[model samples]
Target: MKFAAFSGVLIDHSIQEALQLTKKLGFDGIEIAAREPHLSAATSAPRVKEIRTVADGLGLDIPVIAGYMGGFSTASDKESEQAFSEFQRMLEMSETLGASMIRVGSGGPNAFLAEDYHYAKAAFWLRKCAAEARKHDKRIVLEIHNVSLVETVESGLRLLDLVGEDNVGLIHDAGNMYITDTDYGRDSVIALGRKMFHVHVKDEKRVAEAGSPGTFVNRTKHGEEKFLQCRLGEGEADHQPLFDALKETGYDGWVTLECHAPFPAYERLEHDFRKVKQMLGLA
Candidate 1:
């Protein structure tokens, strides 16, 4: 698997600076976040091309464009249409930036609760997105995030089956599995199998006490507390098994490091990138 850095960690920095930092840290590629001070749907085509030129000049590949397109699965028809229109714009920008994949969320907890209807809605839009993506030689990937519809292996498989499109796949995030199941192992990887098109690497740790305000934390079904953002190798996520599983499955895709810890951006990037390299036997 090739290593990439998610630019969301450096949200305060410009896209140029983020790409520069990623390359300085020895990352093979970058996953651009569709947010402020970075590329977004509202960004002009010239700006997108400029960002692409800068990355190409630095020899950095932009493999995936990560954005919150989950709102497309909302109950409101008007809201879903607006969200999908924005998704199409992002998809166009991603193609312009030379990215082959775009990361989208599986709606939220409510979508999972209303499984049958939401699943069909998600499939309908995802199929449309996949068809559009194919026209641009790109793909639309659903990330397995907490509170998302496809947070588990079973749920993800169900959604994938519903979509039943070649260009639609899963971003197998072990950290998310840790947040939801506390099990980041080979079994999940084996279950995802060929449907795993991308990967997001992070770590999670359970905090005994309530975490600081604004921190991303969730409670398990049994009422245990877990923090989604933690220092690399300092959490419950065991990445070695994930690496082994990826190797066993011959998975060759972008493995982007997502640094959500409350640390200096460069520090988080350097530490997590090195840790993942070590885990993958590349350090």
Candidate 2:
């Protein structure tokens, strides 16, 4: 798989600097942040041009755009309209950047209907968004985030089935699921192996008794207490099974490493990138 990095960790740096860091770390591509002071191709066309120039100058390809952040579902018409607008903006950015895919996640867990209705709403928005994406020949890879309601393997698979669009796929994150009490290392990989259009490589270490009033520590508490993001093989994330699944499914996309620990983010990011490369046998 081609390796990449998310620009969020480099929030303090410029887009060109982030791209340079990515190249130095041996990444093949990048997942640009949509919000500024980062890189939003939709809001800043000139920045997009500069980014394209830099990527071309470095011989790197931008396969994915990660600038979409407003996905909270709304029960009211006004909110829904706002959410749709945000989606449109993200799509526009994706199109401008020539990114084949855009990464997005379900908004806040405000609970949209249930069962058929839930699927209906999701399909309604996804189909509309997919139609727009099709105009630019782009795809939307929905992300499975722990804070959201639909991050589980079953939920992701069900959404894919309900949406029933080849243009829609998932951006699977191993550490996110692992921290959410899901067997993403094994089950999720098996469930959505082929449906994963992109993958985020991350791992978290559980710290007990770091804080809180409860004795029984779980994924949520453990994560909050001692959430240590680490390289692929350095944490509790089951890396071998995930890699095996990736190989079995023939997924050829960037394995973007996300750094969310307390350490100097850039230093650890480079370390994790190299670790993933060596472990994935891409080095």
Candidate 3:
């Protein structure tokens, strides 16, 4: 498996600076976060060209472009339209950025808020997005997160079935899953099978109180679990099982270390990268 850095961590850094930092850290690739301060659809084609040129010059791959798009399952037509339009622009941007996958979200608690309150509408838009992505040979991967339509692998698979698009898949996020489930382990990958399009790595340990009320705390069969983001190995959540699952599944893709911890960007990059390398025993 190849390791990459998430540009979301380097939002304060310019795109070129981010690419340089990633290269300096010996990362195989950089997952570009397609949002403000880093990139957006408003960014001109020439600027994007410069970014691509710099990354290619550094011999770093752009595996995925993270887009903060949702609202497919909304009650309001305007909201859904805006989301799709943004996604359209992102698709075009992704084409120029040389990324094969676009990270997206399922409509979170807004409910998309349909009267029926089901995910059919979200699936509809995802199908359209999948078709559009296919034109560029890109895949649309939804994050397995809390408060979203796809809070679990079972629901995510159901959404894929509803979308019925072969290119649409799910990102296996162990940190998020650990918060949602007490037994967040190898079973997720085993269940996802080939539909596991990408993997995000971040570590969080169970805490007495996460400070922000109702944020990280969740009720599970094992009672309650509250979490606080921590350095990779220092966190209580074990990444070894997740890594072992990836190895067992023969997943040959970018295992991106998402730097969401409050530490300095460079420290998180080097430390987490080294820790993950040691955990997976990758050279």
Best by TM-score: 1
Tens digits of per-residue lDDT, candidate 3, 1-283, equal: 8888999889899989999999999999999898877888688888888888999999999989898876576536787777778888888877777889998777754222223355888888888888888988899999887666776888788788889988999988887777666345798889988898999988876777767632366554356667777778877668899888888878898789885777898898898999888878874
Candidate 2 lDDT, 151-209, residue by residue in tens: 67777777778777789888788887776766776567677767878888777766554
TM-score of the candidate numbered 1?
A: 0.94
By how many angstroms RMSD does model 2 differ from the true structure? 3.8
Model 3 residue 14 CA deviation in Å = 0.9
On the 0 to 100 scale, the lDDT of residue 12 in model 2 is: 80
Which prediction has more favorable lDDT, 1 or 2? 1
Off by over 4 Å in 3: 110-116, 211-226
Q: What is the C-alpha lDDT of each candidate?
A: 0.81, 0.70, 0.81
Candidate rank order under TM-score: 1, 3, 2
Model 1: CA > 4 A from native: 110-112, 223-228
Better of 2 and 3 by TM-score: 3
